[model samples]
Structure formats: structure tokens, C-alpha cells
Target: MTEAQRQIFVFMIYALIMVNFSGSSHGGAVSSEEEADRITSLPGQPKVYFQQFSGYVTVNKAVGRALFYWLTESAHSPLSKPLVVWLNGGPGCSSVAYGASEEIGPFRINKTASGLYLNKFSWNTEANLLFLETPAGVGFSYSNRSSDLFDTGDRRTAKESLEFLIQWLDRFPRYKGREVYLTGESYAGHYVPQLANEIMAYNANSKHRIALKGIMVGNAVTDNYYDNLGTVTYWWSHAMISDKTYRQLINTCDFKRQKESDECESLYSYAMDQEFGNIDQYNIYAPPCNNSDGSTFTRRNMRLPHRSHRIFRQISGYDPCTEKYAETYYNRPDVQKALHANKTRIPYKWTACSEVLNRNWNDTDVSILPIYRKMIAGGLRVWVFSGDVDSVVPVTATRYSLAQLKLTTKIPWYPWYVKKQVGGWTEVYEGLTFATVRGAGHEVPLFKPRAALMLFKSFLRGQPLPKS
Candidate 1:
């Protein structure tokens, strides 16, 4: 038999043996089926005061598609805190890896991936955090129908996510009417607003409405034209690319068109490959992650920077190889057993982002500004933030995008503080708020956890960032 056929046969045999454990793992009695998802404790985990749960919610029964979620309740008052749903956007990134493990989630995996340490500035202190691995094929989420993995788009993903939320509410009914916020970054610039639109539409006719209060997206991709233009400009301004390359990018690339010309693609390649050095484009100042052999790998070689959900972790200083730690931890058989993940014995390793979905992402709205307008008009609190150092989706791109809104300014731009030091800058518009984290990168919380936490707190309170 051919090696390919032999591997298929082995996978089939393993799948049959794993059938008994295929469904969501749950055994001991509890208040609800969600008890099945309650993570009593993770292996090598430190003692924690908050409750945690990780499990799958079947969003599509016909396709047998399920989305995985990890909920970390607030450390203080779990019952009274708001629920914040976080998604990391690669079109196919695992929020469990980025949002839950590296950024806002309470624990950080160690270098060996054998133990966990607490993130002192975890967002769970401000809200009950739920990190979702969405669109069926990312992370632990999967579909019995293989085609579902190849055919996912914004519309279907938003619909399935809405369905997941509704069913998840059924599993944990206590959070039915709780205050909620939709949050994400990067390609989730599409996921967050689109899902918010779906929820708003659902609430229009249904008696049971999700109490969604606000939404906050950081370093988000809102408009293709502005994002592309701003990215090229950022590259030039940051001295990453030559003046000649910048001029070529502006003259050759048609930012308005969804598909760039071959000439444009070539120029982009030249700028990135030839001019840009072995530095992290996500954070220009941060050192690039080195391979296990201690050789350097540029962000482009590892993964596309802005387009993918690759992220970094910081405790005292940033660890460039932190994403590797998540890959190591989640791929472990015992760790998967602990988190109740990978029950079907899927024939693949866990990656931070899925190249398949990234390549096959069916429909992307050229601009999400219309949805932003609608949300603003509807009086939902909206904040668009950026990390100043993130060249991938820089502060300038966000500013250019928001300029199109042209809302009257409520608060003029000014520095905001976290302990007498400048945390970032903020400017509140009539309906929307725009903020910038001082030295943060694409993932704000991972770079500036305390400032990100302060931003989250202010967002929750519907107040402006502190000017003191």
C-alpha cells in the first residue's frame, strides 16, 4: 500500500476506537451540562481562585461542526462581572492559543510548556473571559463533514458563532441577560462586527436577547483601502522599506481593488523580502523569534504578520518564542485530555493559525465601516484601538479609517495615564472612541498588559481613558 493510503487506514482505525470519546466529554453530575466542561484543574497548573471551563458547543448538527470555547471567570466576583467574548483573527486562528494563553487569559504557559504561570494583568479580573476557536476547522473545533473546513466564509462563520452563543447560553443559562462585549483583533476585525450584526438582528425578533453592551477591537482590519495604504505608508515611515519601494507601492498598488495586480504583488514581495530585515513586523522594536536551533526566523518565514494571528507573550519582557510554547502545550496528549480537546483523533498537529482557511476564506467584506456606522447609530459603545508599534495594522491605518467616519470630536486627542506614566492616547468621538497603546504591537494585551487591562476597564465602564 502507498504511504498516503496507509496513513489514511491508520487514521480510520484510530477514529473508530475514539468514537466513544468523540462527543463533548462530561461525566460527574453538576448544575448543567456545562459542568461537563468545567476544568477542575489543568496539569502543572498553579492554584487559582476562579472557575474555568473548556468544551465544544455543537453549532451545526447536520455537518457535525462544533466550536470550542474556554471560559475564565473573573477572579473577584464571577456573578456580577460582564462577559467578554474574545476572538483572534487569522480567519482561522485559535483564540485559545492567543487570547486565552498568551494575552488576556489568566495563565501563561512556561517555556517547556509543562507548567503555567499567572498573568498579573489578566482581563478576567475585569470581565468573565470566553475565548472561542471558531469556524469549525481551527484549533480543537472540527466538523465530521470534511468539506466544511474548506468552505468557511464570513457569513457562515458569523451564523455558526451566533448559533454557538445561543446554545452555549442554554448550557450556562445564568449568563443569559448578562452584559456582554464582543472583542477581537486582526482579521477578527471582520468576525467581531459581523457577529455583532448577527446578534443585533437576532435580538430584533427574538424574545431572549443577548445583552451585548459594547465592542472593542485592537489593531483591527476595518477597510482594505485604508489598511493597505496605511501599511505601505507605515513601512516607509518606520524605515523598513526604501523610499523607492514606498513610491512603487503607492503608484503600483491599487488599494481600492480587492485583488492586487501582479506588479503590485511583486513590489510587495520586494519590499518585504529584500528591504525588510529579520525583525518582527508585528512589533518593529521587538526581537524576532529564534528557532529551537537558535537560528533566526523572520515573521514572514514563520507566518504572514498581519494576515495571520501569530502573537507574542510578555511577562517582564517579551518572549518572541511564546507562541511556540502554546503549540507545544496544546499538542500534548495529556494536555488535550485535560482541556477535553482533540477527541476525534484528527490527523494533524495544532497550529497557531490554519493556512487552509486563510487561503480559502470565501468572502471578506471590503469594508466593515458601514457596520461600524450602524452600530454607532444604534448607540452601542464602540472603541477602535491600535498598538503604535504594530506596522502590520498600524495606528495610522486606524486613524485614516476613522477619519472617514468624521464624527464630531467629544474629547480632543490627549495622553491617557496608568500610574502617572502615559499609557496611551485617546480621542472620543460622538459615537466612537479611538485609542493608541504607547509601545504595544498588534496584540496590545500581550505587549502592554496593564494598559490593555486599564483600557478594558474603561471600556466596560463606558468612561474615557483616565487623563490623570
Candidate 2:
């Protein structure tokens, strides 16, 4: 069958299952009050008024594959708030590591690496946040079938994620049919859209449908070619790379193909050498972590527990060493027991990124623009935001990719304000919206918490960023 036919066939199969599967078969009447999953209090965690839950939801029973999740209800009226599913993209990264521990989650790891502090700007303030460690082999998530670790990619990830959501809903029936917003950053550019598509496809034939209302991605890798080209331009424009190397990168590299020619690779290496040079590529403008023991590789590799320390620079009231603290906190026996994690005593330590899974990523779509197009055409709210200083998947790349969609403008580009200061520029299109977070990096919330929170609140409300 052609690719289109194959997709249709797959959709039909899922549709048939959705049509026939009785809610009772999946235990849809299961009580939402999961007292066992409730997290009373985490070690070193501060007192909080909200409820928290963390555990594994088996996505594939035959393979014994399960994904770990941490859910934090809103500080106020959590049941009334929308359910926001947050994903972190490394194709192998753990959302709990970065999304929860450092960025928008309720707590930040203390410098002692054994304690936690409240993150005043946590996204849960606006919505119930659910951070997942997806696709198995990621963080505390795992698979009984060892091969599943090496055999994974976007499609498998999306498929398992859908199953996870369905099973998760069965567990938290209160959230059933609630408006759900899918949001993530980095490689999740692929995860969020693909999963949204799956949910939409499944909803077509199901009586109990997921109320997927909108999606938001930050500094996302939407189109590989644009992302690569934009990175080169960002480096050159910021004077991080020499003009000569910049020219070589633009002229020699063919990002359309996954593999670059040896000549292109050489030029790219030179460009990277000039640009990185002890600087964190994720945040070009931020200071480098001075106390590096080389324990963290970077935010991208944060999922791997055994990977190097994160290159964190103290800025904007954010802890540079938060990942180290998270590493320490999660590994504590008491903490794990409190969170209901590591039940089977997996052999490997939890990491931020899975090197094995990363190496074995089976498929990557060159561009998720088509998926975005389909989602927007389906009338689902679509928003893309970028941190101005992120070199990994800079705002320039997002601009170029969105331009390719040729969306009509609903609101002309304008500056968005927060606390009487310019947060960023924003523009609304017929089917999508784009915004930038000034002075932020790949992880916007970690770098510019206030601005990121403002942006997020607006996105969740389906409103434009504040004009005044």
C-alpha cells in the first residue's frame, strides 16, 4: 500500500477498535479517587495546598512497557482548570526531568541537591500540569522487552503516548472529556503534534473522546532544514561564529537530507567549534556554568541519569544546578517511594536522556508542518513560541517554518507586554499564533519564568499576549 493508504488503513483499524471497545472493558467506571497514587509529601518538598500524583501507566501490557507520569493539580480549583499534558522532546528525554524539575513545575531543586524549593511561576497555577516520561526506557519508565529500548521513534512514541493517555484517563476519570491542551518543547515539536493527531483520529470514532483543544510548542524542531539553517544564521548574527564559517555552513550543508556530505560535516564542525567554545548552545546569551564537573551534557541530554551534569548558569532567579539537585532528589529511596516510582527496581539509574534510545530513534519527520496544517485546519488552537536566545531551535527557524504554511494574518505583528515591559513580539494567523520570549533560551520557563508564564496563560485562554 502507498503511504497514504497505509495511514488510512491504520486509522481504520484504530477507528474500528474505538467504535467497538466498550468503556466498561477499559474499566471506565474506575473511581478517579486514586488514594494510593496521591503523593502526601515529597522529601525536602515544601508544604503545598494542592494534590500531587506520580506513577507508571502501562501502555503496552504484552511488552510490559509503561510510561511514568507526575501530575500536579492547580493551586486553586484544579478540577475546574484545563488538563495540560506537557512533553519534553529529545525523542528520548524525560519530561519530569526538565519540564517538572526545572522549568514550569511547582518546585526547583535546591543547591544541596537534596531539597526542593517552590517555583512561584509554575504552570500549574494556570492549569493542571501532567509531565510524562514517555516511550519507555526514559527516566523511571521502562519496557520488559529489552528490544523495545532500541526500537523506538516518533510513530511508536505517539502510539504509546495515545495508549498511555487512554489508560491514564481510565485512572483519572474526572479528567475524562475535559479540555486538554498539549504542550512541549524541543523535539516534542514532533511529539505534541503527532499525539494530537492520534487523539484527533481516535476521537473520530469514539464515544469517549479526548477533548484536545489546543497545542503549544516552545523552540520546537518543527522543520529540520529550517531549524538547521536558522541555527547557522542565529550563530552568525549573534557573532558567535566567524563570517567565513557562516558562509561555509550555508553553502555546504544540505539539511534536506539527514546525512550531510563529508565536506558539509567538516564545515559544520568548524562552525560548531567556533560557536560553542564552552558556551551553552541552548542559551547563547546566558553565562556558562562556572562550577561544571562535566556531570551534565546539556538540557538535551538531561534525561540520561548517567549523563554529564547540566551546564546551568545562574540567571533570573533560576538555579543553575537544579538538575543535579533533581538527580539527587529522585534517586533517594524515600523520594522514589513517595512518588510511587521504580517499583520493579529497574537495573539502570534514571537519566534525563536515553543515549541508547536516542541512537536508535527509528524515524523522524523532516517537517511537522503538514501535521500542524492539519491540526489548524481542524480548528484546534495552534500556538508556537520561541525563546529569543535559543540557538538549538531559534525563533528565526520557527518564523521560516510558519511562513511556509502561508497562513493568513489575523492580528498584525505587535509587541506583547508584561508588567509594563516588552515580553516579546506576537502575531496571530488565521489558524495559528506565534510569540517570542525575550532573552529566553531553549527552555523558556527556566530562563524567563514571568514572561513564559504570561505567554502560557494567554495561550491556554486562547487569547493573544497582552498588548499593554
Highest TM-score: which candidate? 1
* C-alpha local distance difference test of each model: 0.84, 0.81
Candidate 1 regions exceeding 4 Å error are: 1-31, 298-317
Expressed as tens digits, the lDDT of each residue in 77-195 for candidate 1 is: 56678999999987788899889988999999998999899999999988999999998899989889887777888899999999999998877776778898999998788899999
Against the hidden true structure, what lDDT does model 1 obtain? 0.84
- Give residue 257's error in model 1 in angstroms: 1.6
Estimate, for each residue in 1-468, the C-alpha lDDT of model 2 and write its tens digit: 896666456556644543454364444543544657889899888877677898989988897998999999887666578999999987687788899988999998787867788999999889999998888999899999999888788888999999999988878876887899999998898899999999999999899899999999998888877777777788788888888888887887786767678887677666555455766677776665444665433443332111111223222224555566666778889989999999989888877767788777777787899999899989999999999988767898889888999988999999999999999999999989999999898899998999999999999888999999
Best by lDDT: 1
